[model samples]
Target: MATMKDVAQLAGVSTATVSRALMNPEKVSSSTRKRVEDAVLEAGYSPNSLARNLRRMNLKPL
Candidate 1:
């Protein structure tokens, strides 16, 4: 599975930019958002929601 770093590299933007483009569309320019979206499709990246939630809750997976 592709990671956010892969998407960022493919999109020619920073990982933070990718996160902003996905989570806060209003924060990034339309062109930037489009690039990120296209890169996501090309890279076949899917965010690991379980890992994200674990991190948010400061819990470790068993």
Candidate 2:
């Protein structure tokens, strides 16, 4: 599976940027979003929803 790091690297951005792009695309600038979208496609990245929610909730996986 492709990791967030892979997508971030491909997008030439920090992991936080990748997170924001994936979760709240409307917040990022159009240029940033375009780069992120292209990188995501090239990198074959897919966010793990459980992990995302877990991070947001500040909880560990069981």
Candidate 3:
């Protein structure tokens, strides 16, 4: 399985940038977003849906 570090290296960005691009593309510049997106597509990287859902839940206050 491809990891975030791989994506970061391929994208020429940091892992945090990769995470932000995946989770919140709007937060990154368009060019950077494109690079990240392209890297993700080329690498066939998919975010962990369960972890993503957990993060979504955490973002919402009880």
Candidate 4:
């Protein structure tokens, strides 16, 4: 499985950059976002949907 570190190394950027690109693409430059996106596609990376959903749920108050 490709981790964020793997994507970062493949994209020649930091892990923080990969995270930013995935979570908030607009925060990153277009070229950097493209590099990160290409690396993710080439690596067949899939974000953890379950974890993401859980985080969203946690953000909402009961």
> Total clashing residue pairs per candidate?
0, 0, 0, 0
Q: Best to worst by TM-score, what's the order? A: 1, 2, 4, 3
Candidate 1, position 33, lDDT: 98
Which candidate's TM-score is highest? 1
Question: How displaced is residue 35 in candidate 3, in Å?
Answer: 0.2
- Candidate closer to the true structure by TM-score (higher is better), 1 or 4: 1
For 1-62, candidate 3 gives per-residue lDDT tens digits of: 77788999999999999999988989999999999999998988887776668778886434
lDDT of 1: 0.96
Kindly report the root-mean-square deviation of model 2 from the true structure over all alpha carbons.
1.7
Candidate 2 structure quality by residue, lDDT tens digits, 1-62: 88989988998999899889888999899899899899999988888889989989999999
Task: Kindly report which residue stretches of model 2 are placed more than 4 angstroms away from their true locations once superposed.
Answer: 60-62
Judging by lDDT against the true structure, name the best candidate. Answer: 1
Clashing residue pairs, backbone N/CA/C < 3 A, model 3:
none
lDDT of each: 0.96, 0.90, 0.89, 0.90
Worst 10 residues of 1 by lDDT: 46-55
Q: List the candidates' TM-scores in order.
A: 0.87, 0.78, 0.74, 0.75
TM-score comparison, 3 vs 4, better candidate: 4
lDDT (Cα, tens digit) per residue for candidate 4, span 1-62: 87788899999999999999999999999999999999999888888776668767886334
